[model samples]
Target: MGEPLGFNEYSAGKAIVIELKGRFDASVALPVKNRMRSLLDDTPFIIADLGQISFIDSSGLGALLASLRHASRRGGDLRLANMTEKIQQVFALIRLDHVFKIYPDVKSAVQSLKE
Candidate 1:
């Protein structure tokens, strides 16, 4: 198993921010995806704060993509913020940066939703 993941959720403007900590991999992907999916019931717009995430794998990426698709279907979107260097590299290498709207911080992501 990998390092256990932690989540801290809060509301900001019209979006829900889910702060992710620890390693994001197959070990925790299902739970993380489930949490994001469940939160969709409350609101379609979500901001995934990845500042504290130390690592990620393909499964983790899949989870985020799945949640993003779900949000899009509901006429909302999933945004990313506070990404670490490692996360940024992975997303860039995979071209996921073009797929998801990434922001420098959670505040900016929330602001973008208003526009």
Candidate 2:
């Protein structure tokens, strides 16, 4: 609970890579959403690197869906990378694994989106 959800931004061609850290829950969802929204204005491709994410709840999932919808509306896309086992299970349980583009890492995610 003390850990803060944070992200680092990097550029991969036309895509933007966001390396995430800490838990993605109700407390951090809104901040992440706002930060991501700010980036949408600059690039159409967004890669969310969840390598360090330890947990994600319904609120986090909602934020991700919202980001996806927002990106889609702007002719952009949001892809997930380096998903932890816990997060992956949540995606599978909710049948969202098929809905999103998943990659082993940020580089792969960026490369996949370029194709």
What is the per-residue lDDT of model 2 for residues 18-110, given as tens digits with 9 covering 90 to 100?
Answer: 988988999999989988889998987799999898888888888889999999999999999999897899989888999899998887887
Pairs of colliding residues, candidate 2: none
* Model 2: CA > 4 A from native: none
User: 1-115 in candidate 1: lDDT tens per residue?
Assistant: 4367899999999999999999998999999999999999999999999999999988999999999999999998999999989899989888898999999999999999999
Number of backbone collisions per candidate, in order? 0, 0
What lDDT, from 0 to 1, does candidate 2 have?
0.88
User: How far is 65's C-alpha from truth in model 2 (Å)?
Assistant: 0.4
**Which residue segments of model 1 deviate by more than 4 Å?**
none
